[model samples]
Target: MRSTLRSSPQSTPAFSLIEVLIGVLILALGLLGLAAVFPVVVRQQRTAADQTQGLIVARNAEAYLRGHTLTTTRSVPNASVPGGGLLAPSDPIPEQNRRGLDILRYQGVTATNPYSTWSFNAANPDRPGPWEIPTYSLVYTNPDRGNMLVAATNQTAGVQFAQRDRLWPAAYSSVDTRVDDNKYANEPRYIWDVATRRVDPGTPSNVGDDGIQFAVFVRRIDSSIRVSRRDLINDPNDPLRLSRPTRDLRLADVLTGDRLGLGGVVTLQRAEHRVAVAVTNNSNSPVPTLNGEGEYAMPMRMQIEAIDDPDGQGLSRFLLPSSATDIQRRLLREPGQKFVDNLGNIYTVVKATFDKNPPNTSNPPEVQPENERRSILVSPAASANAAALAASGDLQVVFTPQVPAAVHVFTMEPR
Candidate 1:
């Protein structure tokens, strides 16, 4: 029997290989874009959180100053300063020695030199008897340290003894283990300083209506090494245990030679006991330092070097000391990095650039490109004639001894 060939049923249309690949490519691109955005979102969140915390700390400081008034006076031994002065049994009590006083009194309006030149303020007042030029004082806090704020010595205040009189979160007790624990070893601390100025020097008739202004500065402390504020208070020798030069240390010597090497936050004990984080992790991979015997050399940690900005941007450049090993040249480029001049003028790092392997352009290779100096541009751009200032023996912008995570300048009136 002749049976007609049955036609195959029409097959359902399916995606071709090329079309599937194209779809996958589109999906992958979208996923990659999301991956990139995640880190940015996380960073933004962290920054916002830090800013909120800073503002809170500042407000807290204002509350403390307004509520706690310093009335008692302390005597300083003249012999400790001015060397063998027959002047008085003790040095004259400093005017700023006291805090939380009414505006008229703190401003010294009745004194012979009303608005006496405060070293922290400008030499010449701008036309007013009372301008709020705040004098700063540093305070360190650690949650593990029994939630107390440790007041650091303020040589800027001129009356170091008065620091003890300032209001503290908790009363000092000889039996308190928390107070003593802060003296030994505590890593990862938070540092904030406060300064108060009389915003309104009330008239003699309305002296009670005066208002006080507070400026609070908060900095991030990324120190892995111990910071002993108590030692600074009590011990005469080896405070902070930073006597050992970090420049002498090798990769193997720090943090027990982690596989990541001496990267990330580095404790610059000699750099005013300030803690610093590396600009980037990629560049911090420790390069091996071989000894004469062809073995890995073990030395102390490398010390950071502060180089003047060749571009005349003030203290805007940094490098590793000549003794630096492979761990040198890690720039402190984190945004909002706060540095303070000797005069307590805070400078924030807005930008940073590091030439990992800059071209060496010297007749006989004067310096290696890898050793090129890095640049950091801070706000309040230093005078264009920074070199001239240095030559004139003026105070150049020096971020003495410490770099904190962030600096917040807050103007809070005492409530």
Candidate 2:
């Protein structure tokens, strides 16, 4: 009887095939849900990485800009070129792209042109809308940066005299017998003549003919000089300044002192407080040579500093102090002050000096209507009465591009 009961109970112990299939189906559904969400998660992570990379690139660029001073001209040295120290890339991209940095330049003080504008959505040359145009110069050794050639005269003969080998016969007389031909007589004359190979001395050195003839020849030695603004602008061979403007304008005339809160007055003594451009040559080629033409590299630290009034007075009489008195009390009350912006927005100043015209008088006589009498007089410290002031005086605008530590990136877009 026990064995029969045990066998009957065992028959109901195992799960049905349908139940097993249902369990498998539940497990499969969970896996399917996980699979569907996996791609979205991965995409999100990739997007985050791209954004981080972009920010890093921008920051690096800014840092570079801030560290360097602003200059009318820039030079990217051949030595700065990566890999090929002597050859610069024809285009700024690929080299800059791989580095995650993009460069843009402007010819004038203000970047008003579309080509000179910087944007993140600029397209490639072949693409539409967003486009980037980066400039690069061919790499060459700069002879101006102390890499110069000097002609050292050595007296190889017993009675050696200095004789300059003139490249331009017209500038130097071949038959001039009165010139002293001694060791120091014609020893490569002026520095310009030696470096430029120009024989034009404008004046000739001559003494009574005294059979004191010396043989002088030029020998190239290395030296260098700092690049100058005129050199970059006047050099026809330089690609960067080939189209630079030749017009002359004083710095004071170009910048409005009033806008900078400098009282519309310019003084030479205050020149130190004014902003001045600093030029740097990153090019491998030195100044006075056309090899680095059209190559200007901007540093991150370039900035402009001008005068600014912290009290917000000193520009124009339009910004002045006003008084609102309690007529019944006969006591000087709150004075009104207003600051106007370029957009015609008026801001009220809470506290100001209050003065009574009729001292000790209980009731000061009213001159005109309250609206008309309330004159927005300019303070003595205010600069100009012009609608908009040029960015000038104690004010400083530092253009420090944010560059990232790990990467370089250039992005351009429409304004």
TM-score list, all predictions: 0.39, 0.22
Q: What tens-digit string does per-residue lDDT give for candidate 1 at 141-163?
A: 21111122212122112222221
Best by TM-score: 1
lDDT, each prediction: 0.33, 0.23
Segments of candidate 2 deviating more than 4 angstroms: 1-9, 49-57, 70-132, 135-415
Error in Å for residue 134 of model 1? 21
Best by lDDT: 1
